[model samples]
Structure formats: C-alpha cells, structure tokens
Target: MTNEELKKAALDYHEFPRPGKLGIEITKGFSTPEELSLAYTPGVAEPVLAIQANPEDAYRYTAKGNLVAVISNGTAVLGLGDCGALAGKPVMEGKAVLFKKFADIDVFDIEVDAKEPKDFIDTVARIAPTFGGINLEDIAAPSCFEIEDALIERLDIPVFHDDQHGTAIVLCAGLINALELVGKKIEDVRIVCLGAGAAGIASMRLAVDLGARRENMLLVDRKGVIHRDRDDFSKLNKEKLEFASAASAERRSLAGALAGADVFIGVSGPGLMKPEWLMLMAENPLIFALSNPVPEILPEAAWSVRKDLIMATGRSDYPNQVNNVLCFPFIFRGALDVRARTINSAMKVAAVKAIAELAKQPVPQEVLAAYRKNSLSFGPDYIIPKPIDPRLRDIVAPAVARAAVDSGAARLPYPAHYPV
Candidate 1:
C-alpha cells in the first residue's frame, strides 16, 4: 500500500469504530435485575470485604491478576519526539490491541501529562494497585531510566518499560540468530550502536548479558563515541557511563566506529547511516536499522551496497523486522501468569532464547497462512519469528515464566494450564 493510502486507512480504522481503538466489554451476564444486583451492590461487596480481610484475595476476587497498565508521558512517542500526553493516546491504545490479540491479556492505556519524572513516578505508584503489571511506554531518556528504576523498587508487581526492554529483547533475539547464521561469536564481535537513548542502551546491555564482551562494544550518541577521556564523559547518565569506551582516540564518528565492526544496531533517526558505511564493516555483518517509519538505512539500499549483510529493520514490509510486538505481550503474559514481582535479566534472557529458537524451527502452517507465504525457514531473510506466529504465546510465555520461577522472582508455582 502507498503511504497516503495507509495513512487514510489507519485514521479511518481508528475513527470509524467509535473515535477510539478500544472499549470495555462486560465479561458476565447483566441482563436481569437479579444479575445486576449481584454484579454491583451485594455480590461485589462480599468480594470487597474478602479482599479487605486478606490483601492476597484481591488477585483472587478481582481482575487485578490479568490487568496491565500501558503508561506513557508522551515525551517520546515513536519517531515523533515530545508529542505530549494527549497526542500519545492513540499509540498507547494500539499497544492495548497487541496485548489483547497476542497474549489474551487486558490493558488499560494511561497517558499522564506530568513533566517531572518524580511526579510521573508518584502518580503511577499511587495507582499501581489496579494493575498486575505496568508497561511504561515512549518516555524520553535520563528521566526514563530514573522512573523505571524507582517504580521497580517501590512496587511489588512487575514493571517493564517496553521502549527500553521490549525493543531490546526482540532485537537481541534476532541478533543471536543472525550471529549463528553468519558464524560470528557474540563475545568477539565488534559492535557499534548508533543511538544511546533508551532502546539502544537497553539492547546493548542485553547483548552483554548474553555474553557479548563489554570491551568489544562501542556506543555512539550525537556527540560521537562515548569515551572515558572525553571532557563531558562525566555528564553522561549512569546507565550510558557503564559502556563508555576506554579513552579511544582512534575512532569517534559513526563512520569511524563502523570500520571493521561486525554488527551495527541503529535506534537513531532516518538517513543517519550511509550506504558506504556498510562497506567498512567486517565480512557478513549483521545490521539492525530499527528506526520506525524510516530506518537509519532502508533495507533495499543496504542490500544494494552489501549483498552479504544480514539486515533487519523496524518495518513489517521488510524481512527480519525487529518489532517490540514480538516480545512485550508474551513477556507480560508470562509475568502475570506467575505473579512475578519483577521482570528480571533471567526472564528477559529466557525470552530472547525462546524467540531465537522458535525462528530456527519449522514455521507452522497457520503462521504461513497468516502471512500468505508459501515457505519460510531460518536464513538471511528469516532471523526472527513472525509477530502473528501462534506459537509465540505458548513458546515465549512458558520460557519466561519458568525463568521467573527459577530465579525466585515469581510468587506462584508453574501454572498447571501451561505445558510441563
């Protein structure tokens, strides 16, 4: 479809069916007066009293166990920067659709207008009781780091910033599979990331957690390579500081960083990476240009420059799309199922492995039917499972839930409904 056509279709789809993308539906019968009374006055009070007597009963008697809050401050809505809270509602509602469609989870999209990070954190913390998990979305850097850390510490329920970890999880999973296809080792690969914001930092950290060497990775922001010798190095946030280079004077620019690098992960804006940069990378380099709407370099342009490169982007039209939709809903599904207190490194890593592994297996017929493709197998063109793959819920959720249980982050046992 043309860009103009897609624009019209998207606006029409959201507007035609009641000016918004979501609505609440009654889950039980309320046709009769007796049923209405039972649902509201007398019947509801019994569960309230039970929940008051024992705090744990709130999960048992209410919808809290299956509910997630998709919260955002609208400072960083997609590629549109600082669009504000009201402008970000549509994106949050779209996230709600993914949660329900992919994992059978319920979502309440919350957009807050607070400018200060503490105020945003306080507001979310105050209302945290209603949700089983919190999915923070599209808040900008520095403050995003602070907000996520504080909420995870302050709340017992699972809190995940999808912009930070969801993108990281899917990208890392695809990277792992890409490395296997290219015969490269994560510990030895020379990695250069073009963006040092939330998604880029989180992706690089998760890569390190999966055995990618810290010294081998170089993080570049707008100023250039993050090096210890830089005069403004102290000004960088604590999270970015951890990955600073050891005072390297040799390479600073994106072009310099790309030289001999085995991997290039771009969370930066469009046209930031040139076609000639791909020529500077190591043989069979893995390129993830994940900027939405338009990537750092278009897949066709990159492929024209280097036929050997394994490329992935954030666009569904292209092969190997590193989408957050592939990870967030299922991760929340697993966390909520086990009542996990936190979505830890182990759980995240488990999700990464499960997603990567699924791509290598035979693609199900139903998945092929959904995409209307005849054949799909693990190769340069297919490094990650399709977002519509039915097995994702069964595969990723169980793996994460198991990891949560093993890591002692979960409060409950392995669910009986899941496969043993």
Candidate 2:
C-alpha cells in the first residue's frame, strides 16, 4: 500500500464510526413489559438474592463467567507515550472487541482519568466485582506494576497487565527457540537488555525466574547501566536488584555489556544498536531488536555482523516477529477458562514452553503443501509460532490452565472441554 492509502486507512478507522468499535446488544426481546421485568426488574433481583446468600453464585447467575474488564489510564498507548485516558479509547475498544472475537470473553472498556497510582488502584478495586478478570492495559510502566500488585492483593479476580508480562512471555518463547537454534544454553550465557522500562524489566524477571543466572544479566537504561552505584534507584528499580548481581559492578556502557554477551534484547528506542555493538557480542549471538516500527538494529545489519546470529524483531514484516499478540490472547484464555486468581511465574513459564514447543513440532505434510514451502522446521526463522497458526489456542491455553491449577491460584477446576 502507498503512504497515502495507509494514511487514509488510519483516518477511516477512526472517522468512519461513532468513535467506538463495540456496543451492548440484548440477548432477549425487551419490547414487552414481561420481557422488561425478567431482564431488569423482578428477575434480576432473584440472582441478586442468590448472590447475597452465596457469593460464588454470581458467576452462575450473572455474566461474570465471561466478563473481562479492560481498564486503561491511557498513559502508555502503544509506542505513543502518555496519550491520556480519552485518547486511549480506540485501542481499549479494539482490545475489547478482540477479547470477544477470540475467546468469547465479554469485555467492558473503562478509561480511568486518574493519573495517580493510588487513585487508579482504588477505583479499579471498588468495581472489581463486576468482572471475572481485570485486564489492565496501556498504563505507564513502573506505575503499572504498582497498580497490578495492589489490585491483585486486594481483589479475588485475576489482574493482568498485558504490556509487561505478555510481551515478556512471547519474547521468552522466541528466545527459547533462538537459543536452541544457535546451540546456546540460557543458564551459561550472558544477556544484555537496552531498556529499563516495563517490558525490559519484566523480560529480565521472567528470564531469571525461568532459569537464567542473575549474574549473567546486565540492564541498561537512559543513564547507562542500572547498577548499585546509581543511588537514584526507585522502589521498582530496587525490586529488580536480584537480577543485577555482580554484573551491576562490572558493566558500564552498552558496549561494555555486549563485550561477551550471548544475547542482546532491545526494548528501548530505535537505532540504538549499531554494527559495532552487534559485532561485540559473543559468537553465534541471539538478537531480539524488539523496538517497534523501527528496531534498535535492523536484521540485515545484525546478520551482516554475524551470519550465525539468530535475529528477531517486533515488526510482522520481519522474520521471527516477537509480537505479544502471540501471548495475551492464549494466556488470558487459559486463565479465564480455569478462573485463575492471578498470573504467576509458573503459569508464565508454562506458556513460554507451550509456545516454544508449538514451533518446535514438525510441520505436517498437509501444512507444508498448503504453504508451498519447506525448511519451516524449528530453526532460527521459525523459532516461535506466528499469530495466525491454528494450533496456538489449542496448545497454549490448556497448559496454562493446568499450571494455574497446580500453582494453587485457579478459582475453577479444569473444565472438561479443555483440549489436550
């Protein structure tokens, strides 16, 4: 498509509508007085009494089983930072529509105008009863962590921030395949991240939680490496101290961290990693230049430095795209299916493994013939399964649901219809 076409499409997406993508539709005819009584007046009171006697009956009597609240403060909408709550409505609406389209989960998009963490948490907590799960989206990092932690501690329903954990889980899946392709083990390798934002911090957390050595990670931010000597560590920054370890004292610049690093993950802005930086990495390095729209280092440049490098990016036009869409839909589907109380490290690890295994599975003859392509085996270019793959929901959701149950965080037992 031409640039003009792209611009027109963007305008049409917002201009052609009543400024929203979803609306409530009644299931029953409400033209008659009897229908109105059953829908809102007398019949609704029956379920209210049942819930008053047994709180769990709310799930049975109401829409709680399928309702998910997509809450946003609009502070961090995609690559656009701090767009405010009202401006964030379109993305929230889009997300709500996807929840319905993908997993049959009903969604209510709420744009909270409050900016303070306390206000946001308290507001969402007060209305927690209206949803089976709360999806916190587009809230700025650092603060997003606090809001999620507060709500999860106070509310019974599951609270998930799709930005941090969802992105981390999918990146881990790609890293799993990329490591295997390059004959590297995560435990023995050095990993360097170029951003200390939400996605970078969460990726580091998941890496260590899933078995990467603490001493092997070096986190870089705007003021260079986030080390112990930097006396400006925030509360959330201090929370990631365990991942810094001895490397905190050793490494200084991005170049210093990449000297012998086996993996390079860029969550920061564009054009950060140059050929010199890529060349400094260890032999057969795995690179995830995940900066959206434009990557830190383009795949061709990384490959130019080392032919053995396994490269991935956030753009769908690129090979081995590390998109979070691969994670959130399936992860939430699994969590919602079993009524998970919270998404924990065990569930995240299970999701990572499930996604890795999907791409690792040998392609069937029919699948190959359909694509008219070969060499689609589990390798550098095919490490993580793409979003359009049919097997994703079937494979990842059941594993996550089982993990949630095993971890003692699931509110509902495994459903009978969960596909193996």
How accurate locally is residue 365 in candidate 2, as Cα lDDT from 0 to 100? 63
After best superposition, candidate 2 residue 407: deviation in angstroms?
1.1
Error of 2 at 324 (Å): 1.3
lDDT of each: 0.94, 0.85
Give the range of the ten consecutive residues with the poorest summed lDDT in model 2: 241-250
What is residue 92's positional error in candidate 2, in angstroms? 1.1
What residue pairs are clashing in model 1? Answer: none
In terms of lDDT, model 1 sits at 0.94
Q: Per-residue CA lDDT of candidate 1, range 1-420, in tens?
A: 999999999999989968998889889899999999989997899999998899889899889999999999999998899999999999999999999999989999999998799999999999999999999999999789999999999999999999999999999999999999999889999999999999989999999999999999999999998988888987889988988988356687788888999999999999899999899999999999998889999988998999999999999899998988889999999999999999999999999999999999999999889888999999999999998888999999999999999999999999999989
- lDDT, candidate 1, at 41: 91
Q: List TM-scores for all candidates, in order.
A: 0.97, 0.93
* Per-residue C-alpha lDDT of model 2 across residues 1-420, encoded as one tens digit per residue: 999999999878877666568988776779999989988988889989999999999888888877899999999998899999999999998888877776667899999999999999999999999998998999987888888889989988888888888889999999877888778888999999988878888899999887898778888888777676666655435555655544444567788889999999999999999887877878989898999889999988877778978889999877788877777777788998898888889999999999999998876666566556665788878788776666778888899999999999898898789864
Q: List the candidate 2 regions with Cα displacement exceeding 4 Å.
A: 28-34, 231-236, 248-250, 362-375
Supply the TM-score for candidate 1: 0.97
TM-score, candidate 2, is 0.93
